[model samples]
Target: MRSLIRQGADVNAGDVGGFTPLHDAAREGHTEIVKLLLDAGADPNAVATEAGDQTPLLDAIGSGSIETVKVLLARGADVRGNDDAGWLPIHEAASRGTPEMVVALLEAGADVNARDAGNETPLHHAVARGTSQAGSVQIVRLLLDAGAELNAVDYQNRTPLHAAVATIDPSAELMRLLLQAGANPEAVDRHGHTVQDLARMNDNKMAPAMLTRALATARRDTGRSR
Candidate 1:
């Protein structure tokens, strides 16, 4: 790669899918190759001409390497840049990257409340993606602490709580965490399903869902709006 760069290779050349060498290196977490390409005048914020419009920073987050993320940020990667899916780097980190990655982006001044094409915030992605998995809860907390609107609605008019109760995580901890954070229990989605209604509908015939039981206890304990 260095030889090609030294030989005057067009470092920013894109492939058929509009993936440049910088995009490939960032996606692969090739920190040194990334630096080489950037030094050769690669556009850090260059969007793929394809439908996704992925920038190198977005690909670096997919690589899940904080070092690579840092390198791109230092090279002028824009945290606000969204993909074809309207997801920012912060949205990707909140949905799947490590907590450290989210923290780094936040420290770099990424917007906690930035909206996507669907108007979903990083908070929405943090709650909606995956199954309230191991790091997911922490990501949720980070967004909340950063002042993510607890009830920020998406294009579907669904809040993070709406997603938490509707998803099939089964742990119920995500819902509990949101409720404790002051999410409105009565918030409704575009389909008009309330958080409790979504929880009940999500219950299988085998037995009631853990989320239902957790919500019941929350209501009983706090006498919250039913």
Candidate 2:
């Protein structure tokens, strides 16, 4: 990269949508190329001229490249830089359920409470989409340990509990984890349906029963609080 930079290649130049070579290299996991570029004086936090919204840190987190993330952060990359969608690096890490990436971002000062444009926090993404449930659950536990807000709601007014229940018959472990993490089982969506209601609507008996149990626990907890 230094040789190329010495040859007058614009290290900071990005393609359309602001993707520079550094971004591509980071996404592609080219650690050597990334090191070369950084050593050659590439702007660690360079926002693409066309993509001027994200820093290399964002790309690193999105790609779950802990080495790249460390390199960028060591070179003074801004961990909290927002992309076009207002997603911070932590959000990217959480979405992918990359606990290593999440830890790196947190160590580098990524905001634990940062929300996207949709008002969805990292916890919301962790419990969504069924395929990532295990990873998401692990990520959620980490975030909760780090003090992520449990009662956060999304644009659709769905909480993390709502997302978990939307999955078809989620495991008892997952249900228990979310509840233990403080997910509100009674959280209502924009349509005014509780997670229990949605579970019943889908004929997912196990999920509704789980959510209902959570609700019962919460009610008892609330009564004690009063």
Cand. 1 Cα-lDDT: 0.82
Candidate 2: segments with Cα more than 4 A from true spot:
49-52, 131-134, 167-172, 201-226
Candidate 1 C-alpha lDDT tens digits along 38-131: 9999999988978499999989988888899998998789989989988999988987787888998998889999998888888877876645
Total backbone clashes of candidate 1, pairs 3 or more residues apart or in separate chains: 0
**Model 1: pairs clashing at backbone N, Cα or C within 3 Å:** none
lDDT of 2 by residue, 1-226 (tens): 5677878998777677877788888876677788888877777777765664877777776666678878888888887777778887788788763777788778878778888989988777666644433366567778888888877888888887777777664544555667765677667889999876777775556776766676666656667877
| The candidate that achieves the highest TM-score relative to the unseen native structure | 1
Instruction: Give the residue spans of candidate 1 off by over 4 A.
Output: 130-132, 203-208, 216-226
Give the C-alpha miss distance for residue 107 in model 1, angstroms: 1.4
**Model 1: how far residue 45 lies from native, Å:** 0.8
Superposition TM-score, candidate 2 onto the true structure: 0.82
User: Could you list the CA RMSD of all candidates, in the order they appear?
Assistant: 2.9, 3.6
The CA root-mean-square deviation of candidate 1, after full C-alpha superposition on the true structure, stands at 2.9
TM-score of 1: 0.89
